[model samples]
Target: MPPIALFIALLLLATPLAQGETDSSRSQPVVSVDFENGVLSPDWKSEGSGNATLVPEGFGAKSLLVTLPDQGSRFVHIPLSAESVRGRRIALSAHVRGENVTRPREPWNGVKVMLKTVAPGGTDYQGLMDLYGTFNWKSCGLITTIPADVTEATLMLGIQDASGKAWFDDVSLLVLGKLRSRPASPPALLPPEKLDRRTDLPRLRGVMYGPQGREEDIRKLAEWGANLIRWQFYWYDGTFPEKRLDLALYDQWLEATMAEVDRMLPLCEQLGIRVLIDLHTPPGATESRQSAIFQKAEYQKKFLEVWEKLARHYKDKPAIWGYDLLNEPAEGSVAPGLLDWHSLADLTAHRVREIDPHRAIIVEPGPYGGWGNLPFFEPIAVPGIVYSIHMYDPLAFTHQGVLDGYPVGVEYPGMIRGVLWNKEKLREILAPVREFQKDYNVPIFVGEFSAIRWAPGDSAACYLRDCIEIFEEYGWDWAYHAFREWHGWNVEVGSVKDDTSPAPVPTTREKELRAGLSKNQSARAVNP
Candidate 1:
């Protein structure tokens, strides 16, 4: 045995294992990235297609060469263990060079080394060193303390969305002595009154998914007694290069969209409707590249810049409720190790507050924004901000006959294709969000929830009313899924003369919704 290995073994023998502790430290050092045998390590795995090969001409005469095709992202990674370096500071380093690499100026897509670790119960954490665009030989590394509960770690390097060549050599992982004793996890920064603001503001109810030029529809929503509108507007419609975006076209789209918003806000103010300008993009849309936006440094900057511009424009508009950051992000959607929904929300919220301090911002937990994911979100600890969630529980029921695979005849308050679904089930489904509300004490927003028009009207009404009742029970602001997007989502419309266009008039469903929402408001008023 090497002297270092013998010494580590002796040290381990001297210390007794505590209860529930594993004998994890190995006699052999975990060398994850040595290309000494002219091959990538078998312990490493690949996520996408790329020409990954061992080259003799590396930093020390051997390296891993990755040639990414003009396609989606490619990743090479190796997994490690917390037991290998528990309670110690570890460093991961690699020498790298790139050629013919290209990507959009924003929405970072590039080669990077990511250290992802998971706590015992599966809380994902990450640290990173990224290299983007074309670059000469350079060293990238990350230093992080291995938390005691961490059970797993992964080191990754890859290029995303760009046709390029990259060289990684002299890769390493090393443990430096025991870190300072500390809490097993970062404590919640929950100070009483992060800053005091109005907590009893009248709960605003409305709908999501609308573009500008719906002035008449806005008026109709006001008539229905709704006061909030989560406006889903598209800032970029045209496709750009996957690896490189055309900023000039983005500028035009921004200018045109902002101008339309300028015109629409006044109409909303006149109609007594507050607006939450929703920066929405359907998943996989060019602008809502949930996969790439957080990783690219330029993209991160641009996202903040867009929010800042909106904040500056609506700084004084009390009717403009807040900025709903991204529509619904997903798990594993962000660039590895760079940023996650929580990090993005914290950054964007702080930036927007700096620009417009009083407006209440709404942030949602990702993995498609369902209530179950709420527990994963860390509190932003900012006052005057609300946590948002979308509800489509028993989607088998609410989405019956509309969404694909749901087919018809899936009923609520009864069996949904052999599975019983009722209001009780709904409450159980929402338990996580309820727990989050209790834990965080932040305001809640049911930003989107509804049954499709194809659903039985009476049953759908029962479901919708139940949702509103639950929201009110918790004092949460609520909104239907959409206003002027799809005829099926409109309670007032059984069908549309033009399904592609908005239904301009109220249908029977609208009357029921208006009545239900008004009842909710009345109950709140009586108790408020």
Candidate 2:
């Protein structure tokens, strides 16, 4: 190890973890660059079919610039030995500039400054920031937690799958202490199966929501003909950025969330709306990635502990129809055979079943990259379980104006990238999920799906209409991505990105949704 790396390793070893410790707020500079010398140093190397050079950039200074000539990505990275950053929490940030960048097929493929760690076995982990189109110098950063077992670490900056010019300067990585200490595993609970007595699932339709004094949303949903509500019950406190996953705060918020649930149950009961207790954020689930819970056995235990507590507490709550095991399970660099998302979800569902067998257990497959997750995931063999998927397919079209650099004018039923996306396309996207239901003879639920409220040319409504039409055809329980949650997903809002407020009048997005949901006008959850 180099002198600085050796010092960091020694300092990390000398530091002791306090009780209930987490990632620290304190950070130290690890490496940085301004490229003022007008040369791309030997420490940095370029990859892919793109031009990379240190150029006179900004005012009298220099920045590393990458020009992608065609449709591909190129990166300039500083490779380092694992000792330099392994097991440490780090932030990678750079002043980045992009010009006339076209949209890429994937969300992560754009103007990028990311930290990537690779285990020798070939498992890769990254915290990425993607930008596109014309943008001046913007400071963007990503925080990543490195595993102790990593063999190589890299800080990468570039433009990907886009034809444009991007410049990077003032790039730096901050060592934010070390990874969280392994908490003691909670005792394991026995997996249970008594599905023969499971309550029959209703043909439900609703939307996912993160409720905050939005009890009135229930009435609005019922009027819209919704019989279900997937409450994104975030148990971890989010009031403080640094304390998002703090253990004490997690427990405190968990209790507070249950209290809120208690207050809403009577209203749901009266409205005949069943609540799906969706644990949106579990312990160790961070803003950077959803894979943290799968990294450590202790973290998985903490996750299961949350479910076990809820299972025992709400086992008798008739207003709650089920427990949505997790929000999105994107396991990163999962150690082979030790733990994968499928096994963990199966284990969690069965554990929840042990306490509340009557209400069905719902689980979503981890998005394992490439051809997406749903089509590849096999049905979990746990009895009394319903398979789920959250659809925002062809994100370039659906999420057009919501996130930065997302290209606009891509409408539904039109060619996107290279393929036509209509109702049949939606069917093709969900084909694997359909096969899962058919092959297993099991129920399916659309835990969440939606386009941005401001998608172009009534695209949001058109896409939603087609999705709902197909979902109903297949008898899948469906829920829009949100209801009174984020203004971006609020269908009632008009198609104006800047106007995040609720629509003064019913908009096209709401019209289509209400048309689909109107089927449930008299629908009621048979809360067993």
Candidate 3:
């Protein structure tokens, strides 16, 4: 199975209530600790080997000092009643400083404050931004929109894995009101320039092809009227949130991939299918949203080298669609000082352009490309490029049951937990991407979109149809998550939506996908 995307959030900022809106936040903060009197609050509890207590010195008058005598972990946190905070945008703010803190071995190992939600659905949705090494007092906070059904929320501050001393002061929780819809307008397109080549194709429609695919699959896709295929070079598949590939193996995998593509170019040309060479797993990618490539300078160097080699090799390949820079860049994980996803993408895109200026360049936003991340996405300023995203929204719905403890029996177009979700909800969630397209005057491409096969109530098929319809309505290009990649995602292998041991039979999932892709032959694209 491919690495599962780490679900993050979009914090809707508070705006003046337009006549009908009411504020749901409490007048007073839920918790505030000055520790001035040198007494820990009864509500605050300490867990793990180390301790959190009052110390003479802090960022201000007094602070809570967290110490780990051993090289283990420790934390101090307070649980909050969820009823009052549910369905609201909440911010966790604290003044923190590290003293002799060890450099982290894992991304989560550091001095930081974390917010955890105790909800029925088991997503690791939390406010966990790690800060390592020694530093002076600094103010840091996390903001997120909490779910309506969440039972409790916890705010924890301490050290994990590599233990050390840290100080926390002026801890407080602020509750903003519920999220509101951003007003929308019709999309505006930028006038064309010499470098603009977004119209290289009429539209993109197909699946992510990988090493698992047969050469003849190109023929099958063309027969079904698919014009594009995202050929993913995902060589590092052993771990779920994959680990860094060894440098020695990198050369080997790169060669093996080039050899395979060499064998498939003609068939692709003959079938009228364009190939999007996707470096599905790049350099030091990891399951953690904070991928190693973002944290390690060495990996960043390797990342550029991969693109340089690919652009040089495939620059002249007419059947190639574009180079998907990196599958999903690990955002917010650049260590203390390093390049960010945007910088890396800009650098790589320009480097590729120096060699080949005509092919469209595709780039995706990260912490993993959910619609939520789209709002924060900083578009690359370069031209002849398409912005990319991966859609599996209502994540608890589309990717149901795949992640352990995520809610089962989830059906689409109905209430899940306390939210009424349907096609309109999908539209609301995607408004950011739509606004992005309009604001930037650039084209959008969905690199991957799909759901699990075992989703109940034909939800998988329904979800697919809804996603495709939205893509068409917006005139965005797209490719399904997979074809012949894994049986779990393969619509062809499943006869029934709920059959645990699916047998070979035509399915609604496949039918909906076929119907959607079939339209590409008749219509050029909503925009094109």
Candidate 4:
């Protein structure tokens, strides 16, 4: 996965509500906390060192000063009850100044101001802006429209990174009663004739990680005549609000995660692109804690709850193509006496059906959900569902310099580190997926497939073309591994040189790839 900070940044970006609307109930400030009285305000609670204190002279009169130590960081937060700001547009403003806020890498010492909303069942949403450099008192604020279900709102200000001194003054929050909608109902959705059938067209192509505010990236997919996008969201990031095992925190995480999807759905609908939401569990849960979904019964049930919530949230959105239950279920890593992919998928599929029987539900079979296991897979019997498989076969060529165990100079076509590889071998490797599609009489989706850009000359395009040919021949819908997040999986960047070039090239490599992928007769069918 790409760095966690990237995902956080993506999630934090939101389209601020316009300030044109006004409401009678929003005349007064709903919440205010400034240490003007020369004492730590009782309304705010400090976390970590809790170094917040009232300084005599500051931006205004007395300001809240947080002393930053050489190691770790500190924060102060005030939790607002739901009744106070529910169904409102909140505007939080503060005067903040930072000094000597330095760090070795990202997430360095900076003063961050955030406005967060929490819903009953899960995390609704939050947005934050950061100030890093030493400067005079500057006014910073954030405006957001709280979701309907929000039960709590939080205002947080803190210093991060190695060392920094931060001062906060005149912190205030005002709630503007809910923005009025135009009172138009959404279009009615008709049920499909058959169970477990594709509602959209047959040919599907695109990439993943369509980050918030990156509609142009998704538009790029549409410009290439692709029909679908398979974006992913993590079950939990490293932050306390998300990573904690508490059900409350998990609820918050779900709300916040789905809010991101809801924010992007409109753009997708406008661009004629469908979305498949992949619940990607982070490495902290899967690797460090050894608490993957299939490993424990409790975790499995919680995973089901996540799907239930997501299905309920997106049941009516036409742009939602499907719900990919889990990114890649690792059957090999499951503990003894735990649920297998077949049983677990069955459970989640049933639960999702309770809320939405028509929205497509996607399931992937084991051995890391790769193509090798698809032939042995038994389809889960559920309506509006499809079988998903990830293809990275002939790992030597596809992964090349990306995989740690693989040696450098592992090229495609012939002799991957002197192992003699070619398109025929690649075709043989993908035969199972093709054969499986023919045997099952069910829809197959290549959820992920890519060749690292380090492959020799046009090898990346060659590999992608071969994979697309098989997908087209099998009438399968597919998405490349990624769209704009990481450059390594980006074949659109044209040719990249890892051996000679220190850094990968920008996304200039899409012309040849676009030609190869768009060559499908289906492209004309969809584009024309």
Candidate 5:
């Protein structure tokens, strides 16, 4: 016979007691027999012809004695049906005694008992118990889990070498009661009815400096219908590690920045203004390099640790609207090659869920705020996650004459025609978002969208008006790129170097533009 077939036959012979049946009913009787009895048949020959017997000593009254062979050991098997031990956790116990037999070359000798379950056309699960040392008689025990899919189970008792001996008795296998399954979790509750219609429209808002500038400026924003404020948190001081990355500097900045946020929270709360805490880094690394940081295990650990701390700090503060994971994560521009935007967004959103389970998370897409690879807004496993797309398309027209030299020049007259009012353009531009909203059942928020001041023929105002219109039509939320800053040409200022500060007052042209845009609030009127 082949070795595999012999192994299978041995396993069957070892476990003779059938489950859910009496011992007398079995073809092979479970009896108290001696070594000279008819238990040793020609087919049931011992491997090494060693002395073995059914004795009446080791296990209180009666037991089976097994003596090891010199060359090697062989297993004893008894046939068992497949229907016996399926889907159960079985317990096995036996009284075993190891005899002391000194060998000329080997160190020790003993017997091993194995319990195995084999499923039809599947792998076998095996459990073993080894009897070692020089014990006259000791009770040994083992517990094994029978897989839910198992069809048959086998038990084997064997000894290795010719000199060593072992005794076994009072073996028992028992079936355990079935376990109850756990209940499923309840579904997430929807946002309250009071907050259902609480939509924010896009408006020119000032990005104030920290706590001191927060109150007065935020109140001004509320009056101007600028429902949101774009805020920043730095990762380091101006001079640290020669402007290189430093762990200490990063931690210190996080501590100080969060402190400032705490101070601004109540102020924003009182003013009824929402805050978008922008997590930004200097433009140094490329998207690929930055994305690598997220892929690293160590970096992910640190990132989550920081967010957990922040979430605990602002657990129930409604003034804080969302967390902008990163600003303009692009490839090859900062870190070289594109950052894995999709993976990074998914991981960041997951981490945020672990911390503040319920907070709107704002995520931006690719290089320099381009929406080329807008992420599909799947039902965020966590509630209140928003897809943020920054629209600065036709950059040449929007960033004209800026010192950094945006690609599109101010002379390029880009007009968004077809929409009745500039605001109506909001509906057309957000056509994708409308589809996404219906598909995923999640709200859309334009985190940042605007045109440059130098764009020709009042294009900036026209774009702004249309963008706001779109936001209101869908009852979506949005934030203007800036309130009054030289970062882009979107500000209602005449010149880049002009003193367009909040208190300095607006120019005549700025006044006329604001009035015309404000009156063209057709989108808001209809949606409201």
Candidate 6:
């Protein structure tokens, strides 16, 4: 056979082999370029193919390299198998490192690589492929989806600038499943044994003087279903000692008050009652002085010292539910509003716990019982601490006839009329209490709420009835202002008598009102 004829036959045979190589390059699954090694593997090609060089930093090594213009981009394309990414959420991942780069003011401007997908029918989809921002070497990823109708795709990585060299390696495309959602937490369970315990246990019922006044009438209050009692203990009054700040006077007052308290303790204990012991100071005492007492550290020190003594004295007593840290602390009277009452209360409660862990502590909100402006229950976080709110709303109904110019004159507004007095309204009034329970799981006590004397014809009684009904419905325990007549007691029909003497006149109006309302269990024991 001739030589020319043989060569021509061989060339024809190699044509199919060369076509197979072209198809194999398009079927490769991963496309990666390492500028350090200057390589494009497995028959893959680059744009500007002639100018781009494969440089070797070391022997037997190759890396695909492109010298990029300072302001323009360099592009690379690798055709992928049509079957490799059909109907999938394709995630492209790569390791990137930047070298000889100008650090931009914003890190994000450092370098960006983007992946462009060309679909089977000549449509293009572009997504952020990966980013390299002043990183020594970092693993970065991008994600894109293959169109449902497209069977083939081409992936292109385009570099933004030639000033910064970026090397990408081990690039991959994968299909991922949907992410899982986090599970929800279960609801809390109530303690079974104490489930029936009243959430609203303390409601203000009545106010009574210290042991000096109307002891007999005060004793009768429990029978009227008064669950709470507020009794004051004064330092300068006869109960302690007049014009004496000595330790002996303090001890004498503590002893005398405790003896009296001991006598009343059994009465309240038997009646399932709670008592709040209020430490009282006259309108102008060293401790009561506006600026000095609460503002100065020494005053607060003395304040806590007094409470420490009291807490130690009644440490184990349960009938005494709490101690009223102060009474009607006026604006500018105590430490400024910002002065940490919660912390002060917490310190007192801490001392109380050291002596009596069981008895709850009640601290009034600052600025003379501003119930609506009460701070959140930070102090009451201690267990057995009850938040107390004193309500004398629309004070006209409470102090309608007072000569001293109290905020509310002694005109009882006859029950807070209409649905505003109903259960939902009651709930709204106690919304903070509910929130307190939800937040810190604590109980609330309305320590003092009452109408003064001379609130006209059965108005006080009607208000009392509404308050009692609402409180009872919510299972709250409460106390009335006063069980008997004092100078401030609001029994319009009752006559005042000395502390030791019987009433000069029988309370005929009280008797008539009580008889009319005594049908229910709560009202039945009125005269008992």
State the weakest 10-residue window (summed lDDT) of model 5. Answer: 1-10
Stretches of candidate 6 exceeding 4 Å from the true structure: 1-209, 213-215, 235-252, 266-273, 282-292, 331-339, 375-379, 403-434, 490-528
| Position 401, candidate 6: lDDT | 45
The TM-scores of all predictions, comma-separated, are 0.61, 0.66, 0.70, 0.58, 0.50, 0.50
Which of 1 and 2 is ahead in lDDT?
A: 2
lDDT of 5 at 388: 63
Report the C-alpha lDDT of model 6 over 211-270, residue by residue, as the tens digit.
Answer: 443445545654444556677775546433234445455556667876777777776777
User: lDDT per model, in order?
Assistant: 0.62, 0.69, 0.70, 0.62, 0.48, 0.48
Measured by TM-score, the strongest candidate is 3
Error of 5 at 98 (Å): 74
Q: Rank the candidates by TM-score, best first.
A: 3, 2, 1, 4, 5, 6
Off by over 4 Å in 1: 1-200, 236-244, 282-289, 331-333, 401-404, 495-508, 519-528
User: lDDT per residue, candidate 3, 365-410, as tens digits?
Assistant: 6546655555545566677778888888767776676643355678
Q: Which parts of model 2 have CA positions greater than 4 angstroms off?
A: 1-74, 77-197, 235-239, 335-338, 368-371, 522-528
- Number of the predicted model whose lDDT against the real structure is largest: 3
RMSD of 1: 10.5
lDDT of 3 at 158: 81
Instruction: List, residue by residue over 409-495, the lDDT tens digit for candidate 5.
Output: 343232422113234434544465565554554556566676665555656666666555555555555666555443344354554
RMSD of each: 10.5, 12.7, 9.4, 19.9, 24.9, 28.9
**Model 3: colliding residue pairs:** 241-287
Q: Is candidate 1 or candidate 3 better by TM-score?
A: 3
| Candidate 2 clashes between residue pairs 3 or more apart in a chain or in different chains | 72-161
Instruction: Tell me which residue pairs clash in candidate 1.
Output: 106-299, 107-299, 108-296, 492-507
Of 1 and 5, the candidate ahead on TM-score is 1
Candidate 1 lDDT, tens digit per residue, 1-528?
001000011122114334322112211234445455433236666777776766677656566777876755777776766577655445455677888766633334566555667664333333332355677876554434455567777766677666788887766665532312222554354332231144334668777755665677877787777878887756444333342354455556666766777777787888667888887642223322133454455666677787888899888976788888877753232334455556667888898888987888888876456675554345676667788888986766777765434666655677764446777777877876776766655677888898877675467777887787777666678888777676677676663324544348655556667875575457456865
**Backbone clash pairs in model 4 (N, Cα, C under 3 Å; residues 3+ apart or in different chains), count:** 11
